[model samples]
Target: MTTKMREEIDEIPAAAARLLDTQTDLIRDCANALKKADPKTVVTIARGSSDHAAYFLKYAVELQLGLPVASLGPSLASIYEAPLKLGHAAAFAVSQSGASPDIVAMARGARAGGATTISLVNTIASPLAETADFAVDIMAGPEIAVAATKSFVNSIVAGLAIIAAWSEDKALVQAVDALPEHLQSALALDWSALLEPLREAESLYMLGRGPALAIAAEAALKCKETCELHAEAYSSAEVLHGPVSIVGRDFPVVAFAARDRAEASVAQTISKLAAGNAACFITSDKATGGEKLPFIATGHPITDALALIVPYYGFIESLSRARGFNPDKPVALKKVTETQ
Candidate 1:
């Protein structure tokens, strides 16, 4: 039987295409609003997989626009009732359910603080969407699995579209336009090389840099959430600082190296770890020592990094079943976590 997770993973490409095709007007409206505001900074609100998507966008916005982006803690409004001074900033609130109380509260607070609030959400009827100055439906459709697959990808796709339109970057716009096809190619990749080692391993490390670091983080979270594996994500540079001490023979490491300035650095770190007898695998042709995992390059750094997650989603769903667990209904987890 095909798992719900697998079905949703297969839906990613179509979901992205739907968002790009159906929500063009909303995305452009948000982008134009941002251009008018010309904010000095940007802030994001999210949690769980949505937070990981926001982290990806943080790098994209900073790299493309040279504007700093920060993640705002939702507790300020939901738990502590603290006032936010975001008069000169833009707030991006991301959520699939769009019903998380903290996330919605924070979006409302951001608007009250005078920021231009934009929401990228899967549910158009959600409170978060109603509260935002501009709302973009991510168009990922109904995701039945507990672990997000298509919705997560669509959230990032929506944000990237907004950034591409806002900055008027022809290169990024082209990349965004081609993402659906790239995502289809990404789904066809084989990452089974990671399975046998991870099956018996007690723990593992996921490494990357720049936008790929966000991919690593999402990978680690999926490992824990679906496969019940103990996986930690780190910057390729940061892992060597202190975490390398425990890396001994056959310590599994997966490095997500996109075709970007950080690719060589990540590959170098993987090489060092491989030299230490760690079973290192990297997703770049430039790798010197570690085994190379196949990945589709989307001709742009950000899109290339985003494509890494599709194959990983398929891999983790299979790993979960191989480890005697259901990927759809992870233990003690529900679809919507309404944290106050």
Candidate 2:
């Protein structure tokens, strides 16, 4: 990254991350949408890294809120792939720049089919934001890094806040307000010890399960975009399905175990891979001071949204430095990606 982008990332710790002043209003508005509408169905539209966060939101919405959630990939909604209304019930499209034509095209189709549209995006005047019936800005502010480290975390939290507001869960709403700060704390972490290890890697895998899987997916994406390395993401449970076959000593795995429910399963998965001679690193809140920590502390459940993402931001920064890649501007990617 250039000096300014690096300074901005480093400066994340200096400023206190806060809640959206409009989040309560957003909650009230989304609550109206849900109160007068169907909680039975919802659809998400996004692309690239935004799509991964959408996947995370979809799973969390379905599992936690009991809403049947479906994620609409941009390609599926594109004119080239198909012509269709993605979901007739309710639709929420999450994007950072909010100008992706594919997402806008899909939003039009959803609106045409009588679905209430909500656009959760960063820029208030963004095209996709303007196209929707309702819009909520993630409030992440101008993200200079093209890899989108902060916006992804903020989008998921905003999605969670919207769901929480509609569900009338005050705890989750409060949790969203607390999350950006929790992330600020994690972003302040000193990863100086991990430099030697990161430099020694031939390939890396960042794996997690449940809600943390969203973090793992983006971590891999960040690694690839920033370092041009062969980094991959796997659901901690899904890692056992077949990918474990390729385990070797040279492979390094960054395993995230943040949730109480899937934490044990992810731990067992980490152990399984470690026993196979894979070098493993763990991120958790329970590390003892005397022991060498493969860990980072995190706020759980709702705040886990940001807690999971902050360290990956650190990892991408380190990867960029390690490989001499500039995190500020990716070689071929633009601030607003418009893929056909």
User: Which of the numbered candidates is closest to the native, going by highest TM-score?
Assistant: 1
lDDT tens digits, residues 221-310, model 2? 877777777788898878888888887777777776775577767777777777777777766543221112233344456456447566
> Model 1's lDDT to the true fold?
0.95
Which candidate's lDDT is highest?
A: 1
- Could you tell me every candidate's TM-score relative to the true structure? 0.99, 0.89
Q: Tell me the deviation in Å of residue 199 in model 1.
A: 0.6
Angstrom error at residue 102, model 2 = 0.7
40, model 1: CA deviation in Å? 0.3
